[model samples]
Target: MQQRFYDQVPAVVLGYDNALEAYRSDKFASFPVQPDPGGVIMAQNGVWGYYGATPTAAAAQSTGSNTGLVVAVVGGVLIVLLGGAWLISRRRGARAEDRE
Candidate 1:
């Protein structure tokens, strides 16, 4: 509903529901348009970039997908190792009790 400009081109903020239609009507209609799950619409010079709900804020954030993946893997390995250690300790405790 808000009017904005990019590179001197007039534009508006489009909701996800109407983004497709608006995009189709633009000069960049020939370009492939896809819906952004982040709920943002950026259009200028026949090209669109989606930044999700907070367009300005999202644009500044880094996805960090690769970094996230690495962290998750390392965390999983640590969990498994700790669990194994706990089980070994419990088994040893049981053996010591039986000997007593």
Candidate 2:
């Protein structure tokens, strides 16, 4: 079993006796054994586990694309709308210096 993909999802690299015979068959009712170190396992639908390798090269040069999370959420909503328009223009310049 090989079929790799990783950050783009879809993975399956089974080996240790076909991942313990597909984690004792029954189509993996609950197969969780991922302590990492080249013997992962997290079976379920879409099967995203059992990776021993093939995910290097800077994690396959990820271009999964969120465009840097939409340019960091549009630069954090333009720094909270320029810090709320500099605190509403310093509260309208302290209400025009309290009407002089």
Candidate 3:
């Protein structure tokens, strides 16, 4: 059914704010209407969820925290240095054996 196809559409993807802004820009014209259903996200007392045909910003899932990104970079650098030292040691040992 047509309704099922619409169920997959995200409101932002369909240009919700853009449409409203465009319609409001023309003061002399009546706002263009969207008869099709859409979803929206909202929060009630900090309990957030999506409703209707629009998804709320707080509703669409958020992955890992960004606060620890600096730590991750530092850890990665230490790992690379350790790996480089191991590689140099292996090469030096091979060269010493060749001289014998």
Give the candidate number with the greatest lDDT. 2
TM-score of each: 0.36, 0.29, 0.34
Model 3 agreement with the true structure over 1-100: per-residue lDDT tens digits: 4566569754424322523222222222222123323322232233233122343344455756886898999999999999999999999999999999
Measured with C-alpha atoms, the lDDT of residue 56 in candidate 1 is: 40
Q: Which residues of candidate 3, in runs, are more than 4 Å off? A: 1-66
Clashes of 3: 8
Model 2 over residues 1-100: C-alpha lDDT tens digits? 1334543555444434545434433222333445545454644333555433234345456558788899999999999999999999999999999999
Question: Whose TM-score is higher: candidate 1's or candidate 3's?
Answer: 1
Top candidate when judged by TM-score against the true structure = 1
Of 2 and 3, the candidate ranking higher by lDDT:
2
Better candidate number, 1 or 2, judged by TM-score = 1
- Per-model lDDT: 0.56, 0.59, 0.52
**Candidate 1 TM-score over all chains jointly:** 0.36
Model 1 lDDT tens row, 1-100: 1444534555543443644434433223233334434333455333444322223444456766698889999999999999999999999999999999
CA lDDT, candidate 3, residue 3: 61
Better of 1 and 3 by lDDT: 1
